[model samples]
Target: MTNRIERLNELDSYGVLNHKQDEELNDLAKIASLALNVPIAQITFVHDEFTFVKANIDVVSTESIPGRVKRRESFCHHSIKNPKETMIVNDASKDSRFINNPFVNSDPHIRFYAGKPLTTPAGNPLGTICVIDNKPRNLSLGEKQLLDILSKKIMAYLNNKRKLLNQENKIIDDALRLQNLTDRLPVGIFQLDKSNQNNLRFKFLNKTMKEMCPSVNTNKSSESIEILFSSIYPDDKNRFINHLNESFDNLSFSNIQFRIKKGNNCAWFAMKGNVERRTDGSKTFYASIRNIDNQIEYEKTLEQIAFDISHVLRRPVSSLSGLVNLVDTKEKLNKKELLEYIGLVKTVSTEMESYTRKLNDIYQKKKEIITNHNKSYT
Candidate 1:
């Protein structure tokens, strides 16, 4: 809804009403004072509940303290009400509006008042830059135009303040969003300065990076790198470091798979990285690390199953084929030969059944282990 509080936020962004900055607007106040031939000048902001004075030139204050007045006591209240036009009370004693006003009857003893509203681009009036006099006097048309020009200058200064404030806030907002996004990512991400092998250090690291390598310290680059490598499984540590060193020396892409100790257990991981070379001949590496424990387990299981089929069942199947050929060649067989053939057939069938059962038993055991391991991750 259209309301005074709605405009308060945008007006507060200029930072004028928070405190008195008499020096900031004193020059403008001086111009208004000298041009209008008045002893008093001020830049004030009129809100719904109070009138806040940004700057004052003379001893007269809207309140007992400087820079504040209740809405009921502020003459600038009328100025904001009629934003499109200037309010001029040439003789406050004669004007019905100010005849009983506190500023006119009591302190500051208002006699003449002239104010131009500081209007926003959206046509909302924030307050006024005004000149006041203790003695009565009217303004010429040229003098009125002069007051209008001074008001424009005041508005221009406040508008510039608002723009800069908004820009600074926008920059802070963008930075926060980027930080949160990197933190929530699943894979660990890091940036390293590869300018010198001896000076290799992490320049940037995401939240996941710390989670992966618990001892990592971004501030101590060499020590953090050493800590991370120490967690690698003994068998794969050398291969991973060799690839990384080669990539750093040639400024080339690197990819490697390794395992790291996770307590008494180990987990598999793959790392991929590429280098960016600056025009100054300095190199940097952008890297990512991903967990590959499940994938590694699956591939190993498949290889075991293939080995069982190739090696375990091969001898039994060959023996069955030879037995069939031998029986066909013995057309006129004796009783002993017939019995021998039957016994051999019985032995072969038993061997085949036993081997098949062994393969099934091994597969079921592997499947159970995989299922339980996967549950822990979930």
Candidate 2:
């Protein structure tokens, strides 16, 4: 009895018994009952103590009636033990094993039984396809063969359904992963779908995109691209349009810095994106917008500082250099007199000019560094 329990658990682990009800199994049950001319036909997973009905024909109970017989008293328990062989009881009342069985002696008496075991793809018996009758009857060889064929069909249907369910679960998992990644991305991402020759709609926008341009959520009826262009400064509109058109034509990435007006205030944004040609002769544009106003201002300030150093300090440095040459080349009347003159001129020109040139070089190098940093924005 313990061995029977272990075997039943093993069969249950195959998951065939866990399947959902479908039209295919119902159709098979109907056909089997009609062909066998039986009042009841069932696709059942037989366990140690009970049978689980997967599909049934003309059975009042959708599930098996509990305790119709004990585990040791069931013929299904004996049949599943030799899964490769079918079990047929032509006369249960005459069979010694079933003559005194509770099911045969009392209500819902059973006298005829035929069962073919249903096996998994790996050839383990999971359950049975069975037909039952109240009176003793025998099945012809042809009928037995037909039952075997239907059992095989049931196995094939179960396998196909398992595969489809697994595939759907995988698809759902992948979609969830992608959605999480998109939402947590650092950059502000947006998608524009071309609705027509002149209209583009916002198909999607991530959280960061909405925060960067609050007005982007406005003008719900207007197309996304049109609204974006309308926000651009009038002076930069042509250049922005030209760059966008060029990017589409070449099917390449584009980077453009333009000023956009939000209400009465204006700021600069660096827009970068790619144009993708879809299969339906339409286009999709994906882009990220970064606010670059502060960076641009910092770069301009550095440039101005460099210009001031070069122009304001060059003349003084040159004049000091000439004065230093004069002092170095002139013959000295006396050591003391020459030293005094040199000290006076050096203090007035040479030292001052040298310090100015050094300051100028420092400012110029700072400007170069700033420019290099700003270039990485796009």
Task: Write candidate 2's Cα lDDT for 77-164 as tens digits.
Answer: 6666667778999989999989888767764577888988887666567678888787899899989998899999998887776678
Clashes of each: 0, 0
lDDT leader:
1
Which regions in candidate 1 have their CA more than 4 angstroms from the true location? 9-42, 54-69, 89-113, 132-139, 153-182, 191-206, 216-249, 278-284, 321-354, 371-378
What stretches of model 2 exceed 4 Å from their correct place? Answer: 1-21, 44-54, 59-82, 87-113, 133-136, 180-184, 189-191, 195-254, 258-269, 288-298, 301-305, 311-378
Q: What is the TM-score of each predicted model, taking all chains together?
A: 0.70, 0.59
Clashing pairs in 1: none
| lDDT (0 to 1) per candidate | 0.81, 0.73
**Model 1 whole-model lDDT (C-alpha atoms):** 0.81
lDDT of 2 at 266: 74
lDDT of 1 by residue, 1-378 (tens): 226766787577676767646575779988888878887888889876899888777755454325788877788988788888889988988988788887888768889999889888877788898988888988889988998898888888888878897898899999778767877887888887755444667777777776666667645534446767888888988998888889978888888898887788888888999988878677888999877777888899899888988898888788889989998897888999999988998998999899999988987888888888766644
Measured with C-alpha atoms, the lDDT of residue 111 in candidate 1 is 92
